[model samples]
Target chain A: MSGDLTARSGGLTLPRIGDRALWSFVGRRIGHAVLVLFCVATVSFFLVRISGDPVRQMLPPDATAAQETALRAQLGLDQPLLGQYVSYMTGLLHLDLGQSLFFHRPAFDVIAERLPATVTLAAGALVVVLVVAIPAGVVSALRRGTATDTTVMAAVLVGQSAPAFFVGILLILVFAVNLQMLPASGMGGIENLVLPAVTLGLYSIAMVARLLRSSLVDVLGEDYIRTARAKGLTGWRIVTAHGLRNASLPVVTVVGLEIGNLLGGAILTEQVFAWPGVGRLTVEAVTYRDYPLMQATVMFLATVFVVVNLLVDLSYAALDPRVRLS
Target chain B: MPVLEVNDLHAEFRLDTGTVRAVNGVSFSVEPGQTLAVVGESGSGKTATALSILRLHPTPPCVYTGGEIVAGGRDLLTLPEREMRQVRGNEIAMIFQDPMTSLNPVKTVGAQIVESLRRHRSLPRGEARARAVEALREVGIAHPEARAGQYPHQLSGGMRQRVMIAMALACRPKLLIADEPTTALDVTVQAQIMELMADLQDRFGMAIVLITHDLGVVAQVADKVLVMYAGRPVEAAGADDLFERPRMPYTRALLESMPRPDVPGGAVLDPIRGAPPNLLDLPSGCAFHPRCGFARPECASTVPALEEKAPGHAAACVLTDDDLPGTSEGRRVSGT
Candidate 1:
């Protein structure tokens, strides 16, 4: 026991993550993400087919029976359901999301064209949420029980409880209709991105802020915080240096979940703002019964969400040293 | 002149239901290089008094009703907050009871020490870090460089306490307030930590205010002992004097209650009667009167002042020295 004690305390250095161990951890997480994506593709491919016959929706109501049969055969929709699923999976291996019926182009190409817009909106909203929420949270926590804290918290509650479509409409009414300071819809300059991003990001902002406030409040009560104060650290230093990092653990989890929500599709926000993103594109595909495009979009979202959650886990390990990656 | 003087300090916690008076009119002084142990049971206001000196208690709930904490020729209560920041770690440092929770879990122990150094000293990062390693070495932690890079969870309880001591003493403050510094460690480790504190006090020549509930800890290193009961000091005297010639009934009861191995095999230990009084609704007159075996009619009607029973010893009780039992007289005691 004494020898064990000496060994444990003998060389007290920062915990080192070996290159091999780190790679193994990353590899394992990546493998799990891939498995999740595959499952998503399988489920979505089978589920979309069950909705109805796509050939009937693809053609007009007055089209001839021969025309309908020819269309189904050409698109390979006439095959058995099991055969079609296997073929879809096989095509996915080659990264070919079969052609879009509406655009008469590969589904992947069509979706990729609009991917940049969704990415931009999601990234912009993320930036807005982080910039606004962190300071608000820290201040609310510091001035807890005061009028300032109550007002900020009330604002956050409104932001969280309000539906995305309602918030989008409100922003459009105030910024576009009343002031005419910005465009109401479409992808253009930074101004056009503002309303949609804020509408989609408001709930995320509220979530991050609430989580950060509660976490910081708990951290402030810790003995280490008192130690920091006793060490003559100013209030700002104590909050930023000693308090924020510890509080960030829970906030990071909330932020990661919000990112998944944004990337998967801010469907309602896109509709209200008329933003040209994958969310709007997915709605269009579902309306026309574009099975391949819908499947590809759902698969793409599932992959992004899985990868993002994996990164969140890695960050958790980084933020808290005691949490080791297995 | 005394290094730290606390005069008639009163601290209370205001809740929705009522106000709980934790420390009532407590007063004492510690000269340079002396160790004054404030001994009491749980919730007896010893810890409250220590936090009061540093003004670390939360304000709305924890209010200092009345008092003055004078140190380094200035009244701490009157000092502006900005200047008070300078005095906190520069002139008066503190180490808490549990070393486990007293450190930032996410930060390196070295970073914490360097934080204190750079906060008060204006030293660059590199210099502060070097000094941090040196501070760790001063506390007898082996592999100081390696230890400095580690987090608090990586170190043992004893080592963590040493780290706390190092952090407290890094600025060479004129006074150090240690609140139950060894309460969380094993007996053997406790002895080592206490010895380390004594050694550090000798080298730094900083007065220490040690707050503890354990009489054994007080006897080991305290030059002066202040016994508190129900949020007020009931007795104050030199360690040897208080141990051998306890005058207050409560103090005598406390001494008698301590389990001794050297007593004859069949001797039954006499535990003190009654629990400590509730601070929210304390009994009338003396707080300890209801528990005192020697309580008289007057003891319940009026509180007794802390009168000097010896040249330096004082106790707050209605009983005269001649009226108390003689069992504790002429007995020599030393803490293990």
Candidate 2:
């Protein structure tokens, strides 16, 4: 311990990325993936069952009796509940999610096609969030109790309290309707993406920024900042290199949850903007009661949320050396 | 010439509740290559005095009501922020207690050191990194290269403190304020840290302000000792003189409380009878009167300012100057 405190007090060395640790990390992630899939399947199974009479909703109102009977038989909706559950579970095991009652297409096929669009929109929104949030959080923390800190925190408060949809409309009124700077709503192209992404991402930006600001403020008061300052590190280096990184662990969870939420929506923004995405498809499926299609889409989203949460957990250990996965 | 001079230093903390007079009218000086140990308990204002030198206290909450802190022939109290920033890590560095929390957990120890190097000196990343590794080696870290890549949490409590010291000394500051630097470490580690600090001071010829509550540490590291009580300096003398013949009753009480290594089973851990006086509502006259065994009616009414009891020695006590020093001053023995 005596030698430990004095040794390596000053030193810089290139990091050797651990090959062994990488393999173990991947193995753990695989385990998490399996668990998330199981959880998603279990939840979707119950939800799909609880939703009332898909066959009645699917059949045309003026259909003949024979045609109605044929459609129920084809969907296996005519079977007993236990038999249907067994059939559904069996189909789930084979990864055959069945056909959409309304779309007349394989449920998995439609979901797969729409996944990339949601991924793109969510990623863009995440990028926007990081670009604005991280620096604002860091600066606010470093300049705590000052004018900048007050303004940033107040802005975050307003952003958090105001509904995203309302804020989105407000933004459209300003940037789209009045200024004519950006499109109102849509993921038509890269240019059309700005409004929706910003509208959807703004709330997350506020949450992450505030979370980061408070955490960083607490960290700045820590003895290490004092030690770093004592070492002649300027405010910028201390805030960015030392303060921000340490404060980001808590912010990671908020970011992950927001990513899941944005992926779930932005469909409204997408529909309003004519952006072709999973959220738009999910909304359409829900309206038409396309049983298999809605189930697959909802399950896929649940899976994504679970996976993102797992990733956040892994990052906690990455950001903080004190955290170790058991 | 003295490397640091503090004259009539007064610091007050203006919290939401009330203003706390942390450091009140204290004065001391330290010659180059010497260590001045300011000994006091928590809330005794030793740290406030150290911070006042750099004007590091946050405003509205902490106000240096009055003082002149001259370091290296310049009044530090009035230096501009930019100049003060330059002086802080370059001229006068500090190592705080709780080394575990004092280092940025996210940054690699090496990077933190390099930051100090780059800011104070014009050096590219590679050169700075190289010096950082060399400094780590100098500080006695094993596998300096490997350890440099590790973050603060990667290292143990002791290792972090070493990093702190390395960073503080990276610029070779003229004065090093080690505020309870070893208080958080274990006994064995404390000894090693002290030896390392002494060695570094000898090599660099830097003046040191060793603020600690531990008298044992004072005996080991301090050239001169200033014992503070209720935000005031109660005694100041050469370490040898103060240890040999403590004039102030508080100093005597403090020495008695320390467990001596020489005595088998040690002196009966004679605790000072009462708590330190409240800064907001301090006792009239001598603040030590409440706790002092020798307190009299005269001691309560009249304040005793620090006065020379011998060459290069001063203590704040009216009895020290009395002609009839030993008799009927009614020395209340312990446990009475």
Give the top-scoring candidate (lDDT): 1
Candidate 1 TM-score to native: 0.95
Candidate 1 runs further than 4 Å off: A1-18, B265-268, B329-332
lDDT by residue for model 2 (B1-336), tens: 998999989889887777788888999999999999999877788988887777767676888888799887788888876677888888999988898788776667887788888889878888888888788877778888787777777787777788888888888888999989999998889888998899999999999999999888888778899999888898999987777778888888887777755565455587899887777788898988989988888888998988898999998898754632443121212211
What DockQ values do the models have? Answer: 0.43, 0.40
Model 1 interface CAPRI class? acceptable
lDDT (CA) per prediction: 0.87, 0.79
Model 2 residue B197 distance off true place after TM-score fit, in angstroms:
2.0
- Candidate 1 chain B, poorest ten consecutive residues by summed lDDT: B327-336
